[model samples]
Target: MSETPFDPTVLLSDDLLERFRERAAVHDRENTFPDDDLADLKAAGYLAILVPTELGGAGLGLAEASLLQQRLAGAAPATALAVNMHLVWAGVAKVLADRGIDSLRFVQEGAVTGEVFAFGISEAGNDLVLFGSDTDAAPRPDGTYAFTGTKIFTSLAPVWTQLGLHGLDTTSDDAPQMVYAFVPRSDAVVTRDDWDTLGMRGTQSRTTELHGATAPADRVVRRLAPGPNPDPIVFGIFSVFELLLASVYTGIARRALDLAVATAQRRTSKRTGTSYSQDPDIRWRIADMALAYDALPPQIASLCRAVDEVVPPDGRWFSYMSGVKHRAVTMAKAVVDDAVLVAGGSSYFASAELGRLYRDVLAGLFHPSDPESAHSTVATAWLGPLDT
Candidate 1:
């Protein structure tokens, strides 16, 4: 199949990014969602970037989608992070469709029609990461399932029309089977106002209380074993989620590196009467940032292409994807730290972009495929499963 061509530059132009950047701090200060940013992105048809062109979308693949995400993150990490939750669903649908499953076609069609999908998988103390759900998926006589659980870090909570979540159905014949489905916003769902955070404040990823929030029978997309099975739904969500997330932090790294370079050239030492760019230490730090940031984009592109083309890797795909996410976030945080050092005390102010980037980068550590999880995945892959 010929790849569909979609250029992100047209939609996320420098001008548009600047507008997002202008409002980023304001939204962060007020602890509000980036409503205007979402509106503009929606108007630009960006919300449907991953939907098939025949479905009234941009017809882009994961490679292109990840690139666009990187660009978006550079302008506003919080906005990009919030948007990531929506893109995850669309990307998952694309992944499923590519594998000959129309299970999530509605997700694709919904995005085309301007329906925002929020990721509602994260629950407190559920470290099993999709394998085990703390939420209860109580099956009804009509086959619909009512999910009762509180989802934490529900990004896009204020405006997401649909929420894609998972729960364990203990009452089912196959007890403890995981059920993946989409639940539309309703009275049964409650959006908590507690979203204040250290960074990515514009995301407003508030807590969501799903008290008997139900998904229609038709909306329940997948039922699978509650362990690390090789199910396509598992692959789709894990692959897309990790790649898109890595792209965001990689973009943050690029922005911080650029800012550091610019700062070094502009700042002159009073005693030496020379620009900081001339300092060996400053030059080395910039070089280190560049070296770290340079490796991520290509890695993201390659892995994303593998996902789009459905190329099976020689080894497990989960470990590779998780590693990419881990490295990207680690590199981004490092680059931001280096940039702050190069930019000096001025960058320490909360008003400084670098300061915000510093705080924002910290949030990357909390996302799925976190440091400990990534390490465990890799260790298991290389060393084989430990003795039970």
Candidate 2:
């Protein structure tokens, strides 16, 4: 199959990124709808990056998507978080596209039409767990699937035109494999139960309910062998998520350092008539923040590149990929903490950029690739290779 056509310039464009940064500040505090941010990306044709080339999408690869997510996060973490959801959905579709399915058509149409998409997987009952009984889809004789369950922390639920839902295939009794279903907002009854949280409030990730919502068979995408066992599609997609999340957190740290340096240079203490930048202690803190931010990018970049190379060749590397993501999250959280320390008391103020960055950095860690669990997987693998 031919690859999708993507404008290589979009990821590295400075002008576009500057605009995102300006808008990020405006939306950072309101915690309201980020219509403008999404609109800008939609206009730039980014929303369709994952759609197959035949389906009128850019068909961009994971590397490009990771770069875009990092750049976008530098401007607005909330927007990046929301946008990440769409990218991951598109990726999931791409993985299953060749599995005797035509789901790419929907992604293509939405991308071309500048339509918004969301991901609904996390649920209160599941507590953000990836596999659970609460998430299941039962098939009917009419060749339709009924998705009856409640999902929470669903980002972009209020404005999503389409949603990629994950659940168990109740119809399959052999071993209850994981399943993917494409749900349209119009066909499914959606309830936005406000996901008011302390961090990344702009995400508006809310609780959603689907009561026996019938989804067409074509809309259903499934993994050939979905089990607790490692899956390339699942792990590969997760690698992208972890790399990008790490990038966002890294960006947040850079922003924190920038603010600290700027403040130190401009605002001098009234008593000393000396610039904070000149202070030995302050300069040391700034240096520490910079080092933390700088050290993470190379590690994450290498890991992402490794995943990109490994996924298309051999279908193995589950333990390695999980470790990369796990490490990225751990390092990112530590870097964000360092940034907060450099920002000092001002970081606590809602109006401060450091405050937003701090909040945004924390949110990504809670996503599907929980760092703690990933570490355990890595540790087990390190102890001995899989015996089977």
lDDT by candidate, in order shown: 0.94, 0.67
Tell me the lDDT of model 1 at 279.
92
Which ranges in model 2 have alpha carbons more than 4 Å from their true place?
1-19, 25-28, 52-55, 94-105, 125-128, 171-175, 223-226, 269-274, 310-316, 384-388
RMSD of 1: 1.6
Error at 318, model 2, angstroms: 3.6
lDDT by residue for model 1 (174-199), tens? 88799999999999999999988999
TM-score of model number 2: 0.84
Candidate 2 residues 331-360, lDDT tens each?
556666766665578878877777777777
Error of 2 at 170 (Å): 3.1
Q: What total of clashing residue pairs does each candidate reach?
A: 0, 0
TM-score of each: 0.98, 0.84
Off-target runs (Cα >4 Å) in candidate 1 are 1-6
* Clashing residue pairs in candidate 2 (N, C-alpha, C atoms within 3 angstroms): none
Candidate 2 versus truth, CA RMSD in Å, comes to 4.2
Q: Which candidate should be chosen as best, given lDDT against the real structure? A: 1
